[model samples]
Target: MAYSLDGVLVFGLLFVCTCAYFRKVPRLKAWLLSGSGVWGVFYKAAVIGTRLHAAVAISCIVMAFYVLFIK
Candidate 1:
């Protein structure tokens, strides 16, 4: 339940990418944003820290929602 740094960074990245999208950034950039979020989660998961894994898992779920429904 505490937030990890990767989670915070991923959230900030998503927010920035969303703003960029609103500013008319290309679809490629948005996809890269989402891709990097997934990469970050996978990296955290592979490293094997329980709290970090939990944070990454939560980020993945939230990002999935945004990717599926928001965009």
Candidate 2:
């Protein structure tokens, strides 16, 4: 198996999202909890031109929502 640049980029975005969620970086955490963050993730996906990354981004965004609302 081989790793692609798209995978790495998606992983990196997810990592940053996770870190921001965990660290509770004031502004970033706030953004992640809002619709804008979801939109931002989708926008990034569009720019990256990968459906897989979009799915990952959606999951990450959903996780952020879960952390903020349910957890």
Instruction: State TM-scores per candidate.
Output: 0.33, 0.32
The true-structure Cα RMSD of candidate 2 reads 12.0
How many clashes in each candidate? 0, 0
Instruction: Count backbone overlaps in model 2.
Output: 0
lDDT of each: 0.50, 0.52
**How close to the true structure is residue 71 of candidate 1, measured as C-alpha lDDT?**
48
Task: State the lDDT of candidate 1 residue by residue for 31-56, as single tens digits.
Answer: 44343555554333333333354665
**How well does candidate 2 match the true structure in TM-score terms?**
0.32
Model 2 agreement with the true structure over 43-68: per-residue lDDT tens digits: 44333434355566687686567557
- Evaluated with lDDT, which candidate comes out highest? 2
